[model samples]
Target: MPSPFPITLFAAPNTLCQTLTLTHERELSALKKAHSTELQTLVARIENTSLSTPNISTTSRTSRDLKRKREEKPDQDRAS
Candidate 1:
């Protein structure tokens, strides 16, 4: 069968244009689905890792040694 419209027609409702639109829509939808799935997986991994960690304490024995070192800096500068 032949097209009812002339061969020069390039407007909407034409088979060539309609096919191109449908193909593009399908590709765009698939890309969106893939991006969402990847985002969800990364979020879950981060949540699990954060929950399994321990709290860091600032009042340990190492901190006391560092405090003594910091206080001696001004005295050493006066001698220089």
Candidate 2:
């Protein structure tokens, strides 16, 4: 039975090296493309989730302003 992976018996060392290098390059390219696709899919999912969800901010500007005013009132009274 013929081997699934057949290297030409007459192929020179340099030729064999070049063939292996080319095969590795093709495999690397394929892996990079797959990784990029997965990353893009994850980003799209995250964007969709964010869009569907409401902003749950820790503190709103209005609330922060009110808190700051309340805090500064004591300083103002002390200064008077």
Number of the top candidate by lDDT? 2
Q: Which stretches of model 2 miss by more than 4 angstroms?
A: 1-9, 58-80
TM-score of each: 0.51, 0.60
Q: Candidate 1, overall lDDT? A: 0.82
Q: Report the number of the highest-TM-score candidate.
A: 2
| Clashing residue pairs for model 2 | none
Runs of candidate 1 exceeding 4 Å displacement: 1-13, 55-80
Give per-residue CA lDDT, model 2, range 1-80, as digits (tens). Answer: 99999867678899989999999999999999999999999999999999887666734766888999999999999999
At residue 62, what lDDT does model 1 achieve?
62
lDDT of 1 by residue, 5-80 (tens): 8576566567878898899999999999999999999999989887775434544656877988899989999999
